[model samples]
Target: MSATTLLLVTLGLALASFAYGRSRAYSVARLGGGVRSMHSLPSHYGMMVALWCALPALAIIVGWKLFEPSVVSGFLQDYIPQSVYEAGEKSVELYKNDIGNLVDSQAIADIQDPDKKIAAQQLASMRHISSLALFVLALAAAIAGATLALKRIKADTRARHNVEKIVQFFLISCASIAILTTLGIVLSVLFESLRFFQEVSIIEFITGTTWSPQTAIRADQVGSSGSFGAVPLFLGTMLISFIAMVVAVPFGLMSAIYLAEYASRPVRSICKPLLEILAGIPTVVYGFFAALTVAPALRSFGATLGLSVSSESALAAGAVMGIMIIPFVSSLSDDVITAVPQSMRDGSYGLGATKSETIRKVVIPAALPGIVGGVLLAVSRAIGETMIVVMAAGLAANLTANPLEAVTTVTVQIVTLLTGDQEFDSAKTLAAFALGLMLFVVTLCLNVIALHVVRKYREQYE
Candidate 1:
């Protein structure tokens, strides 16, 4: 059958299952109508049956789709003519492509020989038959399962509880998909990094002072051994992050404090969202702003003070990133501070403490863990930020503490390494993975520590 037919059949079965389950649930409840009724409403029973019917069958269909192509291709290769089968790998690949095109187009013009045209038609027919068989089997299983569930519905059935548990499981599965995707990405990076390590020593990549990634394009080309020292890039990232934090934290914290503790409801209603507008601004916009405005301003200001400042400097990028993160720090810290019980503030006020004193001595300490958590989260964001650094901070990795000089970062290096046409197996490409792994590990560790601190502080408060 066609895909459209299969879809329509599945949809029909699902609707039928829902109606059947609902009828059965109502029937059971009506039998016990005088006093004791069903554990759940009829609609809940219907939903439960619908989910049971659709979920497993859908899962099977998805699994089949994932592996069916490879299985079918392997089987079809055996049916090819011996002459075509004995061809080189490239020729075999070309023949497979031709067959696929013929199957898709459903036309016989490309196959010049009558025998080959007949064989192609036969193979295409077999493929369609296999697909139809799978679809029918899946549909039957779904309908059967749903029918059984409807039969099982009775007055004493815990359909509501079962349905709720299934919903919770589905939600957890959705969350796990995101986590699994991250793990997949990390593993891919690690495997490629391992390949790179085989060609270049870890010692050289990590400890070398130079930072050139450009290498000879051919075997006879000159200046081929590119340096991969990561120290300067790391320093640049740190420097920029520090600058951004310095810019954002004080203003963000002050705004949070005012909003949470001092500001009236009316003022806060307006100011809070206004402050968040900074966070909403696109990072790419911030990038160009840093490059065009902030960098030039800094250069002119430095010249006045007899200081040499590069137009594209870590200071400019870092400052912009800090401004970008201010909202993150302020909003989170404000919420945590606000969450501290009102009784704590009241007791401090009773002790003759001023508003500022109560806030500093009682409120801040009580909310310290949450505030720290927010700060740590912001720090992680700063470390991984790419756009501002890519635009404002120059690519030359200079291992210097001077923020005035141009600097590169781990993220910038990764971008540069992976950009353009390059071999994946090369050490340069793999370096990006190693850098990514390090960045991931650092952020992961920080998040863990922050969680632990927050949990411990919550226990103390309780």
Candidate 2:
């Protein structure tokens, strides 16, 4: 049967099950015959039965569809003539493709040989028959399950509780899917990095001070000894993030204080969202502003100060990133500070403390934990950020403390490593994964520490 036919049949079954469940729920409700007589509403019970009937059967059908082709193809490999199978891997692949085409079309012209043609036809027939029987059986089982559930529905049945439990299970399953997806990505990166490690030793990749990934393709080729020192890239990331935090944290916190504590309602309403407008601006736009505007200005300013400054300096990129994080810090700090009870501030004021003293000594300390949490979150953002650094920060990896010098970041290295036509097993490609793993670990640790600090400090206020 066609895919469309299968879909239509499944949809029709689901709709019928829904109708049956709804009718059964209504009958039970009628028997109960009073408000507050059931654990939950009748509709929830009906939805529960419909979900049970449809979800399990659908999962089976989907699983079969995904695996059947692979299983059948593996079985068919043994039936092919030994000569054809032994020709070469490529030839065998072509033969499989031809057979699959013939089966799908239900025509034998591609097989050419009479024996292979006959076998292909027979295989196709068997596949079609099996698919039909399985689909029918699945549909029958779904219908029977729905019927049984409807029959079991009665006034005393805990159908509502069952439905709620199913919903909770579904939510948990969705959360698990997200977690599994992350684990899958991490594993895939790790496996590829392992393949690269086979080609280049861990010592050479990690400790080497130079990073020129263009390796020679041939045995006699020149410039084959490409260095892969990760230290410079890591330093560059740290420098940029540190600079950004310096710019963003103080400015953002001060702004938050003014908005949360001191501003009139009109000024607060206008200024709060207007400041957030900065957050809405695209990162690419910020990238260009960093490259075209900020970089040149910094270079010119450094020239006047008699300092040797590169056109694309870490200072420019770091400064721009700082601007990007300002809103994140400010908005979070604002909310946390505003959430502190007015009674605390009033008590401080009654003790004859000035406005600034109350704010600094009382309010800020109360909100410090949450502010630290915001800073940690911003640090993660700075570390993971890509575009601004890619545009404004120079690509050359330099182990330098001078902000005026051009430097590469870890994220930039990862971008270059994975860009262009890449061999998956090459050290260059695998370096991206190693960088990613390191980045993940750093961010995770920061988050845990931030949460702990926030919790402890919050308890003090409580």
Candidate 3:
């Protein structure tokens, strides 16, 4: 059977074994007078048996899947011709790839030799046998574990405690997976960024004003000297993100105030969800809207006013992005404002403070931490944004703050640097990693600052 089908069958067997364990436990309890005489519930006994039956067998299957290719290739050496075996690693890799193609009945890259064809068929047969052997071993393990668990089940067995421990172990395993995954990402980025730093000077990358990431593929190539200065990209990113925040924060916060404190229930309910729908729309759609509608409109408007706005300007992209992130700020602020204890507002009223006065002094301060978090989230979103900037603000890494000028961001440059097939060792491709590392650092610093602010304000109330 296919591995998926076999896994399902194994799970089915575990379920069946659980029922059998439950019945056995019930019979044992009846012999003692009733289930009240048992140390654990019948369900706990069944769950314990199910865990024993599934865990070991599933682990074997997972290990086999993970290691199957290397193990299979190690033994397949016997079938490889002596000439193929004498080849270097790259050649051996090609030979194995050819064999794999033939085994899967796919086209070989070149003319297939009869000897190699024979080896491919033989390798396929061995793999089939290996799979069958694994299936038998896994089934035997499950059966053995289930039998041992059943034998342990009695009127006084601590089945619940054992099952709880097993559940706790699984929970810890899941939590470890998340922590390990994050560590893996950080290490991968750090290593690749270090490789980038080797080719490009860190000072030049950080302080240099130009950011043309071209690398010389040939000695005589034009415009390929490649400047790695990140200042222009950073300026463009800040310009766009600042414009977005300027457009988003005040409007979003004011809307939150209206919805939380002033609006009727029906109006609040209707507007809150409608406002949040902006966050649900795909960013690519916003990109198109910015490119096709907002950019053109802004250009035309600027022209009528005798201002020379670029066709693809940062203003168009930033304004559209602000509209997109409004829901993020508004929804978060509304929730936090509402979360301020109603008693605080009542006390303000008792002090002869108006609703507006109370909101400014008490409600806003109480929700400042959450509001700061939301704004920071929106800033991160703005910085990481790509498609909208690409579509609306053309990818010119110009070092200017004018919103009417075309500009690009670190993310856009990273995408540009790593878009096609590139040698990882080349400074051009490695630059992408450097940019990513820089962005991560920038966001991390922002997070640290936000935390400091939140803690400072938090203690004021406490």
| TM-score of every model versus the real structure | 0.87, 0.83, 0.92
lDDT of 2 by residue, 1-462 (tens): 765676677777777777777776776677778525655566766776687677766776788788877877777776677788679888877877777778878677656788678668767866887688768867876777777777766766777788778889989999999999999987887777677677777787667677777776455767565676777887899999999999999999999999999999999999999999889999999999999999999888888999877888899999999999999999999999998999999999999999999999999999999999999999998998889998998798988878888888888888888888866655667778877777877888999988998988898885
Task: Tally clashing residue pairs in candidate 2.
Answer: 1
Overall lDDT per candidate, in order of appearance? 0.84, 0.83, 0.89
Could you give the candidate ranking by TM-score, starting with the highest? 3, 1, 2
Task: Please provide, for model 1 over 73-172, each residue's C-alpha lDDT reduced to its tens digit, 9 standing for 90 to 100.
Answer: 7877765677886777887777777777887887766778765676677668778877977787788779777977877787777888988999999899
Q: What ranges in model 1 sit over 4 Å off?
A: 1-16, 75-87, 98-131, 161-182, 198-203, 216-221
Clashing pairs in 3: none
Candidate 2: C-alpha RMSD after superposition = 4.0
Q: Report the lDDT tens digits of candidate 3 across residue range 1-462.
A: 568977997899799889999999999999999899999999999998998999889998989888989988988777778887677778888888878877777443343587786777778787889889889988998999999999999987999999999999989999999999989987888999999898889999999998888787555766577899999999999999999999899989999999999999999889988999899999999999999999899989999999999999999999999998899899988988888889999999999999899999999988999799889988988899998999999889999999999999999888888887777887888888889988998888787777777777766554
User: Which 10-residue window in model 1 sums to the lowest lDDT?
Assistant: 30-39
Each candidate structure's count of clashing pairs: 1, 1, 0
Best by TM-score: 3
Pull out the clashing pairs in model 1: 244-322
Superposed by TM-score, candidate 3 places the C-alpha of residue 449 at a distance from the truth, in angstroms, of 3.2
Which candidate tops lDDT? Answer: 3
**Candidate 3 runs further than 4 Å off:** 83-87, 106-113, 218-223, 459-462
Q: Give the TM-score of candidate 2.
A: 0.83
Instruction: Please give the RMSD of candidate 3 to the true structure.
Output: 2.6
